[model samples]
Target: MRRYLLQDTAQGIFFVTISNLTKEDSGKYWCAVSTKLSIGNLFDEVSLTVVDDKTLATMFISAC
Candidate 1:
């Protein structure tokens, strides 16, 4: 499967999809929007964690 996909859903709106995630995929990511001025750039940072399906299931079951 493709590792990454980027799409422009609407004006000034975007989406990113990371497929076939693994533990190694966990890390910091950045999203940025560019403008004419270098200092006008916008940025957002995200921390992502990928867990196995079994682990997620266990978490859900334990929470119930």
Candidate 2:
């Protein structure tokens, strides 16, 4: 089984949180919506990249 946390609001704002993220989760994610105020559907995509602890350490070290 898989678990996910979703945060949303009355406004058109939304968020998806994945705890204990894994490399398999790295990909393009999008939110698609349709409302009475709009004649057509709208969608936006976001990129999520998950890195391993070693990669994170390397990034911080290289940035220094």
Candidate 3:
């Protein structure tokens, strides 16, 4: 598996894309955005989850 860095946007949003996702890729990821504020740096946290192929299939089935 390879870790890919998402491009930073001017809108203060960051994302990461994984290619050729696998079963082992299923996990939680932490994403944060930082910017300088009046007092100090401000941080916003976003959580990411990569689903294994099997789990994704299950999700699709359940959704239907």
Candidate 4:
């Protein structure tokens, strides 16, 4: 399976896709933007949680 894919929406918007998510995939991820030599790089981080179908359903139910 394709693990990673980077896409540009043709409108200055970008997306990153990770396929076949698993428990191992749950971790911190970073999105980096490079700037000109005069400026440093920009980075944003997000935490991901990979849960099974049952767990996801339970979470949804509990939220209601």
Candidate 5:
């Protein structure tokens, strides 16, 4: 149940929020920006990782 939050950059740079992340949620996220000066666009991509809750807890307790 992954979700995306696209903010309105109508006023400039802003923040984006994601929710309900899962293992498959891992991927490249791009944020494109366009302005009057630039005929093209600017993109910022990030790699995300989402691990299973059960697996995470198991690893956490074992490491401790």
Candidate 6:
């Protein structure tokens, strides 16, 4: 699982980014803050859906 912690100083935005999305990656995700001693709790769960698509031309090309 790839996780990211990025802060945009220009926009003043705080959020996390997930990369390398896959079908199994589709699930409930959330964010939390914590210290080195202990982990934080879960809050504001969000659902993510990943769709896999193939074009007809690509499919036909591969079949050839």
Best candidate according to lDDT: 1
Worst lDDT run of 10 residues, candidate 6, spans: 55-64
| Model number with the top TM-score | 1
Q: Kindly list the per-residue Cα lDDT of model 3 for residues 1-64, writing each as its tens digit.
A: 4445455554555445556556776655444434465755543333335555423211101110
> Per-residue CA lDDT of candidate 6, range 1-64, in tens?
4244455444423545555556776777654443354544434556767685221110001110
**Alpha-carbon error at 15 in model 6, in Å?**
2.1
lDDT of 2 by residue, 1-64 (tens): 4446666654656556566667776788766676566567776666778885212211111110
After best superposition, candidate 5 residue 1: deviation in angstroms?
8.2
Q: How many backbone clashes does candidate 1 have?
A: 0
Badly placed stretches (over 4 Å) of model 5 are 8-11, 53-64
* Pairs of residues clashing in candidate 5: none
RMSD of 4: 8.7
Ranking by TM-score: 1, 4, 2, 5, 3, 6
Ranking by lDDT: 1, 4, 2, 5, 6, 3
Root-mean-square deviation of every model: 9.4, 9.3, 8.6, 8.7, 10.7, 13.8
Report the candidate with higher TM-score, 1 versus 5.
1
> What value of lDDT does candidate 4 attain over all alpha carbons?
0.57
Better of 1 and 4 by TM-score: 1
* Segments in model 4 whose C-alpha atoms lie over 4 Å from true places: 37-39, 53-64
Q: What is the C-alpha lDDT of each candidate?
A: 0.58, 0.54, 0.43, 0.57, 0.50, 0.44
Tell me the tens digit of each residue's lDDT in model 5 across 1-64. Answer: 4365545544564655666566776666655666566456665665666776222210101110
Poorest 10 consecutive residues of model 2 by lDDT?
Answer: 55-64
Span of ten consecutive residues with least summed lDDT in model 4: 55-64
lDDT for residue 2 in candidate 6, whole number 0-100: 29
